[model samples]
Target: MTILIALLSGLVFGVAFGFLLEKSRVFEPGVVVAQMQLRNFILIKVWFSAIVTILIVVTLLRELGIVTLHPKPVLLIGDLVGGLLIGTGMTLAGGCPAMIMAQIGAGYRDAWFVVLGGLAGLAAYLTLELLLRPLPADGPGPLTLAGLSGTPFPALAVAVGVGLFACVIALERLRPWRLDLGAQADGIHHDRPGSPRRP
Candidate 1:
């Protein structure tokens, strides 16, 4: 019963998140490509806001003893190389893992190639494990802001979240992306087939 509840809740949250992704136009290839090219900053702002929100909620829960924070093992060189590869792939494909699904939901038939390419990459990584084994895993392990700075994690999270949120706000004030100006007041970007929405 607990497992079933967890699955159902996960489904609900996933659906909600996907809906938001589509609505935000983060799923749009043009937006992703533009962000990768440093021509647009809306995607960064959106992610920054999300990170702040998550930090606030998670920090509160952990502080209240309602949840425990599990820090993942850090492999600096492995992460750096993996991040480079993933970023390159995202730039070329114009979609990350979640955004690929969002693109499919938004009716982009071309995104299927991105999904297939990702799956193929995963398969290649699994099959070529011996060749990839040389990527170093030795690094300063699981260091968090609290551990490094001697502050409570929750306090550190709140401070960082507020600072980041403020920076995003300032950036928006300085130069905002005008993706939503054309959106309808009724909240429907487009209703007809072949018409694009700003989400």
Candidate 2:
């Protein structure tokens, strides 16, 4: 019963997440590619905002004893390799896993290929897991910033969330979201320098 409830909760949250992503237009191929090329700030803004919000929510849940924090083992080598692979794939596909799903939901035909490629990659990784040994035997035990810094989890979460939220605000101010949208309210492409100002 608990498992079934958890699954239903996940379904609800997943739908909400996808709806938000679609509305934000961050799942668009152009937007994703622009972000990878550092030509747009919308993706980073959304990413940081999500991170900060999650951190705060999780901290509150922990304080209320509604959830427990379980840090994963710090496998530096595995993380580096996985990050490189995921980053390369995302750059090539112009969408990460989550973004690709949203793209498909938004009626993008090309996103299907990206999804297949991701599954192929996963299959390849599983087949080569033994030979590649990406997960080494030795890794730093599950460690959290709070544990490392000898601070309470709630305090660390608050500090980190505040810092990231500040960054999000600064980014929005420096490069307004409308600039990255590629088209202004007047339907003019004035993102480039020397372009006619929006009326």
Candidate 3:
């Protein structure tokens, strides 16, 4: 009933959000590159805004009994390693694994290889985990951001918001936004967004 409604709502919202991301020029190569270059601000703004809103909303929900904050202990070694790998791959590939998905749906054929590679990587990892057991990291739980810091939820949320706000302001000063020019009119960027550089 309510759970089903909420799940449906989340799916609907995600689809709507993907469509909006496509429309907003947020998923462009120039945008990602600028973020890497420390030039673009919109991507920073959106992500920061999302984090801020989620932290505040989740904290409130937990307080109201609408949500629970059940978190497992953090494993910094694995997290740091995973982040480094994901970041390095994203930097080299010009697209994060998640964005690779959006690219695929938008008709970019090159994304097929990336997706395949990702599948292979996952399969390899699973095979290794089955053999090694605790060789890498063992986890039987979920981790939340607030759990790692041990700060009050409201304070953590505020801290995150302030930090993200600072980042947004800093990136905005770089003026990374580019005009669409005639690209939209031609329906080229409208399909496989950002720039034509990404595969």
Report the C-alpha lDDT of model 2 over 1-199, residue by residue, as the tens digit.
Answer: 6999999999999899899988887888778877887777778888898898788788788899999878888878777877898888888997888889998988888889998888898899889989878465467878888889999888888888888889888888888988778753221356578877767
Cα lDDT for residue 49, candidate 2: 84
Put down candidate 1 lDDT per residue, 81-108, tens digits, no spaces. 9899989998898878888888787777
Write one digit per residue (lDDT tens) for candidate 3, span 146-180.
Answer: 66677776787778778887876676665533432
Ranking by TM-score: 2, 1, 3
Ranking by lDDT: 2, 1, 3
What are the runs in model 2 whose C-alpha is more than 4 Å off?
2-11, 184-199
Worst 10 residues of 1 by lDDT: 180-189
Q: lDDT values of the candidates? A: 0.77, 0.81, 0.65
RMSD of each: 5.5, 4.0, 5.7
Please name the candidate that would achieve the greatest TM-score relative to the true structure: 2
What's each prediction's TM-score? 0.81, 0.84, 0.71
Q: Decide which is better by TM-score, 1 or 2.
A: 2
Error of 1 at 132 (Å): 2.4
